[model samples]
Target: MSDPATNPPPAEGEERTSDASSTDETVAVVQAQEDEPNFTPITKDFGFLPIPKHLRHDPKHPAYFGLLLNATFGFAGTFVLANLYYCQPLLIQFSHTFNVSYDTVSRIPTLVQVGYAVGLLLISTLGDLVRRRPLIIMLVFICASLSIGLSFTTNFAVFQALCFLIGVFTVVPQILLPLAADLAPPERRATALSIVLSGLLLGILLARVLAGVIAQFVSWRVVYYLAFSVQYVVCVWLYLVLPDYPAKNKGATYFGLLWGMAKFAVTEPQLVQAVLISIPSAACYTNFWVTLTFLLGGPPYNYSTLVIGLFGLVGMVGVGLAPPLGRLIDSLVPWFASVIACVAYILTHVIMVGADGINVAAVVIVCIGIDVFRQMVQVSLTTAVFSLDPAARSRMNAIILISLFIGQIMGTAVGSEVYTQHGWRPAAALNLAWSGLMLFVVLARGPHVSRYTWVGWEGGLEVRKSKVTAQKRRDEEAGASDIQQRGDEKHALEAKQSVREEKDLQDATTVGMQEVKISETSEGEKQGEDQPPMVEVATLSAE
Candidate 1:
């Protein structure tokens, strides 16, 4: 005999029993599977190529973000953003090549900026809705194709259209910034963002130098051809190395996401503050760069295109300072950084106003100061906003960048016009005015002491306390409800047990009465059987 727990084979007439037992076991297994919830991962493996085990990204896995991935993001962001500024130094060349006036050719950069803003609004938002690796690859490929069109086009209209398209698709940097923030550790997120931003700054500065040098010796068209090659290379690099990021907003519709962005702009005070500060900062930055071309190329300077482009090298100091500023933002409150940047912006513009393009030293100082301070402000604001909501980084980034590019468009259009019509002093003064407005807004709304009656610090504190109190009340209410429910459940269980006991007692009493009646009937039957034969015999004799 086998052990009963082993479920030994059925005996010769127990086939039905064996089959029924097996059927029950199968149903139990299936039911158990059905009870478990389905789970899907937020990050996916890179299927396009055989990515190394150490480079893969998964929240559960140990393949953490490291230096190599950071460098890859930096390089990819650099070249993709370089497409935007290549045409800046080539504006004069475009004028001659397309046989258009300088004023007409100047609109090309503005159109590019407008297209960039449109892309930030429409395309970059999709980063949250789709896998970022594929989206980024597609954008880079299209941008490379656009570069080819730009390289060969002679018609100004076609050239302008291609430039716009180039700007539209060159939003990979915007997408990468948020991706970097997502991948980096919490303590180092700001530093990671700054690394990518540093590359972008380098691209903006170096594209001018690269375009000017290539166009000076060779043709301006070569610049675009080179851009085309560099883009393709970056595309391949991204395909091989970039880890996959699954969609964050999986079930959301496109229009709904846009609407959500509008809501964020209005509802999130930190985001609103960042946007307001970034707009004027961006405007001033673009204003100075756009007008500097005119100021350097005319009057006392008469700088050639190459000479003008070389000035971008002076701004590299800002790129070098970005990482440290990011670390600073991580360690301290971002408000201090913003205040410092605003002060620097105001002072830089004041000096530019006084120098009036006659002092080369002053221009270089302005370049370094603006670039460094702009990085400070940008890194600080980005750290603040990204910290507000981790899930909405792409959309939040889109909002801030859309505003920034709008400011760029304004600066490019208005700065060129102002500098061309008036002199350097007026253009510098306009930048000064923007800086002043930025500082005023930062101080008024930022975390600072002000005599203004509308500061609302006390009100803000009260609102925070009220929110805390309300949350505590809700928790207490929930706890009370749970306790009441448990008590009700306990009372219901006791009532059910009492009813069952009463039912059992009634059944036991009825069984006892029936047993008693049966016993009595049996006794009567026995007595009658003992006396019945004699009575029947007497009746027969009498008859």
Candidate 2:
């Protein structure tokens, strides 16, 4: 006889069994999805691709394939976000081309960021509310159109308005970063985010370098033209080939989504503190980049745009190091990393304060240091925010990006106003203020809410309710309840046994009495019969 566990499956029944199991599993998955009221991931196909069911947005896909997809997203993000920074290096050129004051031209960068802030706030939440592919594609087309228009338009006012619109449309890449985090496996999510973020940082660096170099060879309008053409092609390819990932917040209305993000920013203390620290941190990074072009363009240094742009290449040293900083945030406590980063920020700012123009080496070294440390702080803080709510990853990211961009606006506005008016030293003083603010955010207090509430990773906010101790306490309570139940059962059994014994004893006594009465009656009957007959026992008793 074959053991049931070892028996081979029937060949014909295999298909039936597989089909039935798949059906049941699919139904169960649908039901489970319906039961969850909060944060249901969108899983339906766009009806565009006829690929196999398991391939699209399957978190269990091969790790290598996931990485490849992430890399694609990263590159896409780089190209899109590069639009924001290309104008930064071109500020001097814009001032010259438009025959405007440097101060007036500076508003172009600030307005672009302002549009970015508004767009980020408005469109950032769209990632969760709508289909990412169509939303992103729509934005791409608009950006492409705007880019082409910017290349041709001679009117400065129209060009300035287009800059804002360009900033709005370019946030497609911002949407993709949270998407990367969403699709990435939990074990590798941080690293995956870092890899994608590396593309973004590289784009920031190379946008200046490339813009500076390309503008030297041609006109700045060529930059927008190239971007427009390339983006149009990318948009088409993305529409045809990109896999659909549905929104988790598909049910939320537009107003509801934005309102919810605002609510999250206000309510979650970790998020609030994270934003606070990042504001100045962004101020520091953006101020340096925005002001550096001006500093190098003026004064004893009097560097050309190409040379100033090459300095962005030196900052590329920090770009390559970004992944390692992300890894550090993952491995170490994020709060600790943030504090150390804050210290580095302070020291770098001090170094910049001393560099009065002749010391190009100090400026270069300090700029590099500033980029690395500032990015580390950013990565650490961002990673810390992710721990607050995993289900709200997109919303959390929206909050984060919105907060950072707010700082971007601040930084750009400050750099444009202060550096153009009061010179570089006062600007450096503002950076020192940023560093001081970052340190205060780190060591001053913990979150008003709790930490370690979601992910188990260590962040700047470190509060965990003890799991092991709670388990032990629950076990003790259970043991005591079980002992009391058993004791009650034992007493009930003894009482039942005593009642059974008493019932049997009472039956025995009644039977004995009956037997004794029967014997006495028989003896009386015999005596009456012997004495002879008179109406039986009654007559005998009368006589």
Task: Write candidate 1's Cα lDDT for 1-543 as tens digits.
Answer: 111222333443333222211222112222343354763333333445454443343333322346677778888888889988898878888998889899999899878877887899999999877778778988999999999999998788999999898888889999999888776655566677888899999898778788878888999999989999999999988877787655676578989989999999888777877888888888889889878888888888899866887888988898888777777765555666677778988999999999957888899999999998888888878976786665688999999998897788778778878888887899899999998988876666644223233333432322222243355467878999999999999999999999999999999999999999999999999998888688789999999
Task: Quickly count the clashes in candidate 1.
Answer: 0
In candidate 1, which residue ranges exceed 4 Å CA deviation?
Answer: 1-57, 95-107, 153-157, 298-304, 356-358, 417-422, 446-455, 458-543
lDDT of 1 at 245: 56
User: Looking at candidate 1, what is the lDDT of residue 331?
Assistant: 56
For model 2, residues 35-146, the per-residue Cα lDDT tens digits are 5676333344344534344334432221122555766777777778888888977888888888888998888877887788788888777776766766777787888888
Q: How does model 1 score by TM-score?
A: 0.72
Error of 1 at 59 (Å): 3.0
Q: How displaced is residue 273 in candidate 1, in Å?
A: 1.2
lDDT of each: 0.77, 0.71
Worst 10 residues of 1 by lDDT: 18-27
